[model samples]
Structure formats: structure tokens, C-alpha cells
Target: MIIDIIGDIHGYADKLIGLLTQLGYQHNGQCFMPPKGHRALFIGDLIDRGPQQIKTLDIVFAMLDADVADAVMGNHEYNALAFATLDPEHAENYLREHNETHTRQHEAFLAEVPFGSERHHYWLKRFCEIPLWLETDSACFVHACWDVDSMAILKPLLTRDNCLTPQALTLTSKKHTPMFDALERVLKGVETPLPKGIVMVDKEGTTRSRVRVRWWLDDLDNRPIREIARAPHSAIAQIPLDTKAEPIDFTLKTDKPIFVGHYWLTGTPTPLSTQVVCTDYSAAVDSGYLTCYQLDTECPLPLSPNNFVQYRHT
Candidate 1:
């Protein structure tokens, strides 16, 4: 089957529809129909960070109901669930604390789908239907890093279809547990500690001592932190190397192709490695493009850049 692995939508409905149309999906007053023998696979983060939140959800659900599309749960979607779920131990608080930072990051989605409204509850139910990861005979689709170790730990806790069970959700919502760590690693990717006394400030001005790493790199253990980091090299190029750093052994060992999103990658879309691809191209930001990696599931490994399709707008 031909699968179109779509990146994070982040409420950019217009860009999403543009990419869909370009991929030959025709809208029939409701859902978009994919070309024969083709289907769309979303890597999640379908809501928040953009203007058309409701429209974007509607489009995706319509296609899902039409059986032309499937999706995995993203970190944002997981956060939404936690935000809505009241803490059993402390009823006044939520599973996701309503602190300033969390609220600010979630305000856009909450603004569109008011908390406790029928629409909000409905979407949350739909979100529950989304699995945490999907695996076919030849490929795997996840929101972020597809760490085999994490998946093994998470397997039984998840539902039969790999979705979060209520118990699993609760376990994952709380920090410090094996479940939480596994969920975080898969949904948010892996991070490595920076050298002592070195830190980098993110766009939001938050100082970070650890950096997200390219987990798919076979030689990640041998690379410099700047080169191994997922962020721009120039951002951390000046930091002194941590010569005593412990080796990081988080590389993917599979020969089967894996597709993931969640990283706000810039520039032209390309296969991250011979067997791995990151579909996210910062679609939620201005000057960013909505992208997808078109794949024939039966095709050989070592994906090519030519298959990267995008909806670009200045």
C-alpha cells in the first residue's frame, strides 16, 4: 500500500488541505478521498500553535471516519488529556499542572475548544482512540523517537491496539515511573545531558542543560555533542566538549524504515538517516512548510529525498 506520512499539522488547516490536494486527495463536501491504494498517516500534534484548531481536527476526523487516514497520539494530545483529567489524589489540581508555562503553551487549543465544553470532551474521546504508535510489517510510525527499549516497557500497559489504557494514562501522567519515562522518551524523543556548566537558551528564553539528540544515528556515541544534538550546530558549537561524557547507546537497530515527527526541523525535508525520516518541518511557524513523506510500503529501504512532498507558502 502507498502511505503518505504527514508531519505535525499544528492547526494549519489551510496548509494541510493544500498538501492533501497536492497529493491527489479530492474533497467530496466532507472528507478528502485518497487516491486508489493510498492512505494518509499522521504523526500527530494535530492541534494547537496555530489558528484553525477546530477546522484541522474536523478535517482529520472526517478522513479518519472515512477510513482514508490513521494517526498516532502526539505529546500535545497527551498533554491535553492530562490537563482535562483531575488528579485523583488532589482533586483541585489536574494531572497536568495548570501553571503559567503549561497554560500558555495550551491556551490556543483551550481557547478554541473551551474547557469542559461538549466539543472539548468529544475531541478528547477521539484522541483516546489514537494509538501511541503504529507498526506494519515493513514500517513503524511514531510521534518522536521509536526507541525499542521504551516500546518494550510500554507494550503491556497500552491497550491491545497500542493505545493508552486508562490505567496506562494515569501511570504515564505521573513522573518518575517506568511508564512515564517510556512515554516521554517515545513522545518527546531522547535527550542527553550537556557538559558541566554549559547550557543553551531556547527560543522562549528557557535555559536548557540537556539537548535533544539524533537517536537514529548509529555513531551517536562517537559524535560531538554539537553534531549529535538535534538543534542548529551554531547554537552549541562553542561549548567545550565533554570528554568524560558517558557513551549514549540509544541508536535504532532496525533495518525497517521508521517515520516520526515532533522535531521542529527546518530547511528542505530529507531522510534523517538511511532508515529513518522526520516529517516535521516546523509547520506551525511562519515561513514553514507542511510536509509528508510518500512511501510505498513494499519499497526497498534507504528512503530518498525526492519522495518528500510539501506545501510551501511565503
Candidate 2:
């Protein structure tokens, strides 16, 4: 079977439809289907940060329901669930505090589906059903990093079908817990503390002291800070090499291919490594493109730009 590994679609239904069409998927009233027995494997982040949130969800949901596609849960989906759920300890508060920052991050989604509406609750139930990752005989897929150790720690905690249960979500939501750390590493990627008194503004204009590291790299001890960052910044290269920071050991080696989408990358899409591919090309932004990787089951995965397909937003 040929699999189309798709990137994050942050409410850009038009681009998604365009990409599906480009991949020879025809709409059969309810959902798109490929003619040659191909399937779409979505990397999640299906909602938020765009104009058509509910429409996007409908398409993705229909595809999944029709057995045309499978998806992993993105951090946005996790946060959405937490935001909608009331904290058991504090009846008035949400699992994820409903502060300005949290609300703003989810504003687009909430605008389309009101917080307590029937539609909101329906989707929340579906969101919780999404698995954090998918592993097959030949490949693995996740929203972010596939840290072996982290997944090992999370394996026993997951439900029989490899999904996070309500109790698991609550446990992972707590600060400094092993579950929290493992979930963070898998969903958000590995992060490293910046030098003393150093902070950088993220895409949301929030200043953060910790930056997501390039977890695919196994040897970070000798690498420069700029080289170790997944989202490199001009200021990061200026940080002193002697600055103390925690060491990251990404020692997961596998022959099977791995696909992920979360980092808002731009430019022409390509395989991250011989066996690793990141299809997210900042599709939520005006200048970004919706990207995908076409994988053939008969052959071993190739690290080339030729397999990358995209639909540019116009």
C-alpha cells in the first residue's frame, strides 16, 4: 500500500482539499478517497490558527470514519481537551487554566465551536480517541519527537489501543511528573534551557527561555547551540559555547522510517534524515505550504526531495 504522510493542517481546508486532489483523491460525497488503494496518514494539528476550523475537523473526521485516513493527536488537540475539561480538584477551573494566553492560543477553534456547545463536546470525545503515535511494521508516526525512552515510559500507561485515557491525561498534565515529561517530549519535542538571562520571543510573541532541540541528533554534546536547535534563530548562534546546559541523549536508532509534524518549517520540503521526515511546512501561515510525503510499501524509504508534494496557499 502507498501511504501519503500529511503535515499539520491548521484549519486550512481549502489547501487540504487541493493537496488531496493533487494526490488523485476524489471526493465521494462524504470524504476523499484515493483511486489506487492509497491511504493518508495525517500528522495531526488539525485545528486552530486559521479561518475554517470546524470544516477542517469535519473533513478529517469523515476521512477517519471512512477508513481513508488515520491521525495522531497534536499538542493543539491535547490542549483543547484540557481547556474544555473542568479540573476535578477545582470545579471552577479547567484542566488547562483558561487564562488569556491559553484562550488566545485556542481563540480560532473556540470561535468556530463554542466552549460548551454540543458540537464542542462531540469533537472533544473524538479528540481523546486519537492516539499519540502510530507504529507499523515498516514505519512510525508521531506529532513530534519519537524519543524511545520516553515512549517506553509511556507505553504501559496507555490504554489497550495505545490511546491516552482521561486518567492518563490528568496525570500527564501535572508539572514535574514522569508522565508529564514523557508526554512533553513526545508531543512537544525535547527542550533545552537557554543561557542565563536569555529569552527569545516565539511565533506567538511569548518569550520563552527553553528552546526545542533537534532530538534526532544523537551527538549534541559537541554540537553548537545553533546546530542543535530545530528552529534555529540568529540570536541562538551568539550564545557562548561555554554556557552550561543540560545534555540531550537521543539514542533511538531504527531502520524503519519515522514521520512527524509540529515544527513550523518553511521553504522546499525534504526528508529530515535518511529515515526521518518532517512534513509540516508552516501550512497555517500565509506564505507556508501544505506538504506531504508519498511512501511506497514495496521499497525502502528514500531521503530525497522528489517524494515531497505540496499545495501552496494562494
Candidate 3:
């Protein structure tokens, strides 16, 4: 029942492979399945801005197909899927512009994705159903924030937003479209009323559907990202304007453990607030490396002196 949570891959398949290999995976000739009782969890962003997008997806999809791994749909994956549905023209142009050997490999990887298949949908239902705030028997996992009142409250919201009926969750349906399309619209909106934040750009490098919201839930008065932060990444990390913000930005409560990977810090972990911790060490930035956290305390690696590190098996 041990969980080996991974961070964003961003198309670095070789690193993922190396890391997985170092973690003691057994290749069944089709995919690398974890040793019995070990489970892998992906934090998403499996593709884009890397040399081996296809290979990355191939590894992920293979592990996923083999039921040895679980993945949460990342904002990037949401963006790509939304791009396919909302703005095919721009998406195609984007593909043409950045599409390379890796893209071709990625294409083949996705070709056999079997997105809405029974088993895939079942996993998708469970994954998409995970809350923005996750609480495990041993730790907590979240892609970005630990906002909602607690994991209990976050579960329903996550489930409602992510999980859907087989038909509703299909990539072809409109119901599911909005699940990811909201990001597109947020990224596309041309009007930046906030004048101080993020202005998102579509995959096609255009701004057609744009809008913004302050941070988590402080004051989502409906503004666009452009006015929130000059840079998209900043906008993403920007704490909404409010004085009543929580003491911590939402993370380790000092009562439990927290593990996350959206900030991209590759080498070292960061303790933003007294309680909040970030594990994303920007492993996908270069060929240098990527990371995995194994939960075996009896034989843990020397990565974290802190006890709350996420788990991968190596």
C-alpha cells in the first residue's frame, strides 16, 4: 500500500526511466510494473517543453495501462485536451510549430491511449475524483493548493469537478469539455481588467478567452490572469490580494505531512511558510535529473532531512 508519488514529467522520459529503474521496477516486456504492494502516482504535466514528449507519455501510459501507476490530470494535460477541443486550429498550429521527433512519438503514444475505455475511465474517475486537498493515512498530496476547509471538503469538490459519468467524462462530450475548457477560457480571455496579474496565452500563442480570479477563494470577483501577474507563472503562484489569508499558503499543518510539485524547483525542496512544503525541484527543466520519493523510512535515501517527504521506491 505504499505510494510513490512523482512530480511533473514535462516530457523527460529518460529521466523518468532512470528514476524508475533506480526505484527497482520489473519490466514485464510491456511496461515497468512496481514490485508487489507498491503503487505509483503521477502528479501530471506528462507532456510539453521537453525533448522526449512521446517517450514520456509512452512510459506513463504504459505504466498506467498496466495498473501499476495512477495519475492526476495536470493543468498541462487539461490544456492540451482542451486545446484539442476548444481551439483545434491553434492547437494544430502549435503542433506544427513545436512538433518534432518527440511529438511524433507522443502522437503514437496517445494513439493507443484508449482514453475512455472501461478501465481507463475507472482510473480516471478515481484520479479526477481526488481532492485539491488529499489526506493519506501517512501523508497528504496536492498539485497546487491545500485551500478548502480540509481534505473532507475538498474531496467532494474534486469529485464533482473531475469525475463524471463515462459519457460525461469522454473527451468528445461538451459536459467534459468545460471541465478542461475553463482553463482555455481563462487562458484565452483578451480583456485583462485587473491590470496587475497574469494574462494567459493559448497553445496557439493567442488570447481569445481570458479572465482572472484572485487567489484560491479569497475574492474571485472575476478578473483575468493578465491583470493579476505580468507573468503566467507568477500569476499561477501569486497569492490573491487579501489580508485575511491563512498563516500558511496551505500545506503541512505541522500536525501532518505534505508533498507537492507544481513550483518546479528540481534540486531542493522549499518551505515557503512555516508549514507549507514544496517538493517540485524543476526536474523537467534539463537533462540533469528528475526525482521520485520512496516511502520506506527503514531504508530511505538521504534526500530529505525532513520527515515529511513524499514516497517513491528507490
Q: If scored against the real structure, what TM-score would every candidate get?
A: 0.95, 0.95, 0.54
Displacement of residue 145 (Cα, Å) in model 3 is: 1.4
> After TM-score superposition, what is the CA distance of residue 217 in candidate 3 from its true location, in Å?
16
The Cα error of candidate 3 at residue 7, in Å, is: 1.2
* Sort by lDDT, top down from the best: 1, 2, 3
Question: lDDT of all the models against the reference?
Answer: 0.88, 0.85, 0.48
Clashes of 2: 0
lDDT of 3 by residue, 152-271 (tens): 322332345443233322322232344333322222211223234433453235432233322322333343332332234533343345412222222223334455556555344435
Worst 10 residues of 1 by lDDT: 237-246
lDDT of 1 by residue, 112-202 (tens): 9999999999999999999999999879999998888999999998889998877788878888898898998999998888778888877
Off by over 4 Å in 1: 233-238, 241-245
Model 2: worst 10 consecutive residues (lDDT sum)? 232-241
Write out the backbone clash pairs for model 1. none
Instruction: For each of the candidates, give the backbone clash count.
Output: 0, 0, 30
